[model samples]
Target: MPTDPQAYRPATALLTLGEGFFDPVAPADFPETHLRFRNQRAAAEIGVDPLTDEEWIRHFGRFDPLPDTLPAPLALRYHGHQFRSYNPDIGDGRGFTFAQLHDASGRLMDLGTKGSGTTPYSRSGDGRLTLKGGVREILATEMLQALNVPTSRTLSLIESGEALARGDEPSPTRSAVLVRLSHSHVRIGTFQRLAYEQDESAMRRLIGYVLHNLYGEDGDDPIRLLDLVVARTATLAARYMAAGFVHGVLNSDNINVTGESFDYGPWRFAPTWDPAFTAAYFDYQGLYAFGRQPEAIHWDVMQLAVSLRLLVDTEPLIAALDRFAPLYGEAVTQAILWRLGVMPGDPDADRSLVQAVERALRDTEVPIDRFFFDAFGGRLPDAYGTGWTEVRDALAGRTARGERVHPYWSGAPCSMLIDEVEAIWARIDQDDDWSALDAKVAAIRAMGDALA
Candidate 1:
């Protein structure tokens, strides 16, 4: 039976864990609440598709409590490693868990806000998000979701009518508030904070809450939890590679226990298969570059294991961490095959195909997305060298997944490279034109459907 799109089921699951996990905070009062973007597809899943634009602003922009759900927004607290440097003074500085609900599939969903307001963790900075920053996040999430990456969906964007100064972008930029729909907001840093405080009881309680509410498990066994997180994180890293995405920041706090990618900032798609391709300008050392992402993610998972050490012994945790490399390798093979729209082969054959693809990508320096686009369903044009020929041979005997009937597959691949991102933002910034953004999203979704 199809679930009713109008029947919203709200949950207070996070509240059950107690107030120590979060601090209640108020949303910023924006002078103007002009709705910039609304994710109807995401809203339909959560049973909020029927909301009018005015009503949407009231809830998302003005921060009205959802019916029978959270009475106040929660500014979640945690600590994290920023660029491998431990920072205890970080948390939900500008965002909060606004509300919780279940999607059509009955999975717990969080309606979280970014740039909502200032919290105790604001740390002398204004609690706000740039309008351009919000726009970038929208593009990043949409493209990632289209690429089948496990990620947060941008639910709403509303211009807040504020001028803000930023060091990265042009000063006096526009401001906006964004709402994201995600599976879980409980991060690795959430556990790290408890361990840092040496509060074993709180750590155990949080573990129990996470396993039950987010993962649908009931036990608080640290080893079990670490194993699960490790596997999911590995899959996530593999997907990022398949999509040629540089997350720019793979800090422990940005990594949630659910392993769903969220909090997009300084994200970029690799133009070519360059290991040192970095997305963030401030990442001088290339610590979180495209090639190092797997390592960074593994390191973050290790932090989670360290945090869990407060509750369990070290040897089992080390055993769990050992699973990451093998799991990541397997996941990479699977992810690449899926992107290539081909049936799985034997492990050795599949690995050979992946390696061949990598070699072709590096040797040809072909645009990453274009290479995948050109090689769709194991079909590659003859205009390439031995590396591509190696890839073509490795793909032999594997059945393509489905017919590429969609019009999108007949054209150049839809990509979200940085220049296109800047052009999209320029349209909105200069002329308030959203036609390009809309068109790109339509194209991206069309590609997603074709790939599907």
Candidate 2:
């Protein structure tokens, strides 16, 4: 059944756990509330497409409580390992869970915020998001979704009319508040925090909450939860490889239990197949490089396993962790075949095809997105050379899914390269022109339609 556009089913499942898991906080008093962007498609799924621009700013920007929703925002509590070094002080420094509700598919979704205000976790830094940062996240999510990645959707971006200082970008830059729609806000770090406090009771409670609310499972089996999370995380890592995305920061806090990618920071789409390609400039050690993402994700899952030790036996957790390798291998194969738009063959043949495609991509050094765009339906030009011929042979006997009839496939694939992202922001920063951003999003969605 199609969802009733007027029926907005609000949920407060997280609030049922009480104040121990979070702190009630108010939003910042911004000087202005200008609606810079609003995702009508995402809003329609949540039954809020009827909200006017003014209403959007009023609710999202001003942090006004949505009707029958969260009475107030809750800054969630958690801890994380930064570059593998445990940090007990980190959580939602500049963000919070604004509200929770069901989507059209009846899945519980969170309406979370970024740059909303300072929280208990905001150390010495100011709680604000630069306008450029907000724009970058929008681009990241849009392009990832186009590639069929399970990612949080950018619901709205509101110019908060604040000037913020930062060392990363120019000082005193414009600021904004962003709302994202996600499946769950529960992270591996959330478990770590409870384990750190040695609160086994709270840890079990949290596990139960996740199992029931987010996963629709009844009883809380820590091993069962670990298995589910491991499988999802493995699939997520494969999707990242398939989409050519480098989520610069893969910290434990950034990884959600649902394995839906969110919280874009210093992210990049690889221009080529370079394994050493790092997204964040400060990643001097190349710890979270494009090629090393799978390892990093596996490491984060191990930390989750470590935290679950407070409630379960260690051997089962380790056994569950052991599943990562095969799961990731299988997922990457499926992901690559999906991207190529071809039916799968025998396991050996599919593996060979994936290997050949990777070799072709690396040896040719062609733009990754362009390669996928050009080679859609297993069609590669002769100019691609011997490496591509290997891929073609591997694709033999496999059926192409459908014809590439969409207009987006006619031209260059919509790519969110760093240069293009800056160009879009430059237009907005210099001439206050938003046409480029709007057009880019439309193109990305059209590409998604074609791929679908």
Candidate 3:
């Protein structure tokens, strides 16, 4: 961690794209501020992990710009389709991209906020996040990262000391502001807004910016861009399935251009292999259910393809879009094998094994997360009981990488069930005792280290 804040060079890479892209906005403070969490692992990217707790709170809590950060945060402009219906007015209502810095790996990272304050897009609702909501997102990101899902990390969370009323859960809920470390905040909705405006020049400029920065274009055309994004989206979709997760909202706006998952609202890990299992309680139609996630993500990618048409032709875009199904098919098998701790030398055989595993999980109705944590890092036939004998034999005669399971796995499986998460938070809510939350975080980190 760098001691000098001056060493932190914030890059306004997206801002350089110019007008209609984003608007300068200031973070409005709350009644009070108390830093709740800081992500040291993510902070080491920009070399600020060793800052004193007071210093961390001052910068993130006060919304103070890091040295050479953006003169002011930018509330990005974008439009998106919600549940397949186009909504042209939505953008960053409660959050803004605060700063950008290249990590040790030379990958550009963004420090973005949620519940910092209101903006032009704040419609009618208060531009605030519930403290409970903040805690939930923290847990969501931590668990997803532990499970090896490509996701954003919560860098900081602060209780904003505001009592807010809401209809979704209990009223007079505590409020908070959260900061996330992500590769980029640019989304598919960014392009959709430009397309809606019929600003073809802006569309081309945005595409060029994305290709030059994130996609690493080499004399590539829009077709190549579409193909790249399609592949990434397919890979991410497969990982989500293997992780047994359902991102309740896969709206176009929520689909990151980097194809990394973020914005973890109304998300859940499946307790079983049920296709119709939905995460968001408000999702009455089962639109973004666990099993339908692949379909939803593919549909979102289609929106990105449609936006690209403002700069390119129809034929190549269609061809690129066609790659989703096969790419997803191949990805799912690889993901399952990765979770099961095996190398796939034979594609046909590995696929058959995955199919058998899925059939077994469905027929036996085994708890989803427990099954993986217990079976992770290929085990021998004698290690399992008769109940798992079929699964063991099917995975027999296959090369399995060893040294995966830990001493902790021998007891109870490491799990992040909803009930457990709520119980952890309940302790904090009732007595401001954070020991449970801290213990859970430590355990999850240990699980990730063992898996690695």
Candidate 4:
């Protein structure tokens, strides 16, 4: 806590990057251009005051020579498992945490930037983000919040007037910087890096830091830290399942050790419930698929436990790892039940509904957004149009599948709200009226609130 809660203050000191905390190479790639947004509005929501333009420049901005900033970045050097493979080297490739601030909400928030420039960890690529990626992240963060998912919020988006090149698209493309708000950017791999180096002292220090910064000092026992993190990971995994989200990449490097959801790369929501639904085109094996998320998280936690063993009792660590499965299962079941908005009527009906969802994913290939929208919301009338009719009819047909019909009929009242909204969307599309569309969306959103 600060003496003056309302006043914004500069960081007490600068944290410069070093070999001990990061790799020893420049970023493999750099953003050709850069842009910035205040995101002060978002900061305020979490109880942090925005810096004035001068303040931002004085504290965070490095607007001087091209690829500015002295690269005095530090406070990184965490390790994580990339796609289940132990990767000993990884940390702050293009960005670094400048400071950690205590928000008005009493939450400690990390102020970090992406596309700021390159560092030793840059590897063989430019450390920059495309404008499109920035925009998509903004939309994803906003939608995730609306849907009540635990995620890093986009604090700001800025464009640097530079050109860059990349394999996925083109070179010298426009660049943008994104500020991500999260509990901590620390990942499971952070510990892995130290463990791999045989640096037991550093690993112990890292565990101490995590316990103090994330879990708090009162409960700072290293054994308890392992237990808490494992349980938290399980809970988060369940939350993802409940919300129909698929984090395309669940590698150790991307799994935040703080237990807050971070590293939003090619993430998506389940259209139906296909176990293999994945957002990343490159995730060929579906290692991070929709259904495998829980398992991936479990694996990540196990990695964390193994790393933490340098400082804690091995038995307690193993015991913590063992708790993940049952906890995750209980959480998933509860989340699904709540999502269906059911009363405690028939146990078979709940079972049938889940089975029906699983079958729907296998039966057809449809847009994930449309599938959830139609099923959770409602079906559009035929007058709605091509996509609307398709979704409406699909839900109607899905309801007739064996024992599933019992819950389908019971859920109609809950589902009708979605159906009516789809009808309104169809009306708007037919009319090509923006104002009408906005008004209808507002009404539908209000209805969702009432239903919620």
Give the C-alpha lDDT of model 1: 0.91
Residue 450 of model 4 has an lDDT of 35
Which parts of model 4 are misplaced by more than 4 Å?
A: 1-37, 46-72, 341-452
Runs of candidate 3 with Cα error greater than 4 angstroms are 1-9, 218-220, 380-390
Error of 1 at 151 (Å): 0.1
lDDT of each: 0.91, 0.91, 0.83, 0.60
Candidate 4 lowest-lDDT run of ten: 9-18
**Model 4 C-alpha lDDT per residue in residues 1-452, reported as the tens digit of each score:** 21234633323112222246543333223332222445554566543444555544434445321122234344367667776666555678777765565555555566666776777666775777766566556645554554456678777666655676867755665676777877777788877777777777666666666776666665336677777788778878987876778878888877776667876667766655578778788988989899889998899888878777776778988887889898776666555544443332355554555555445544665444444433453333344344343334434433221222333334322221234433543453356333533343334334344334
Backbone clashes for every candidate come to 0, 0, 0, 42
Model 2 local distance difference test score: 0.91
Residue 267 CA displacement from its true place in model 3, Å: 0.9
The whole-model C-alpha lDDT of candidate 3 against the native structure comes to 0.83
Report the number of backbone clashes for model 2.
Answer: 0
Clashing residue pairs, candidate 2? none
TM-score of each: 0.98, 0.98, 0.95, 0.72
- Tens-place lDDT per residue, model 2, 412-450, is 877889899999999999998999999999999998899
Give a tens-digit lDDT track for model 1, residues 1-452: 12244668888998987888999998999999999899999988888888888889999999988886899999999999999999999999999998999998888999999999899999988999999999999999999999989999999999999999898778899999999999999999999999999999899898898888878898889998998999999999999999999999999999988889999998999999999999999999999999999999999999999998888889999999999999999999999999999999789999999998988898889999988888788888788666677887887777998777789877899999999999999999999999998898888889888988
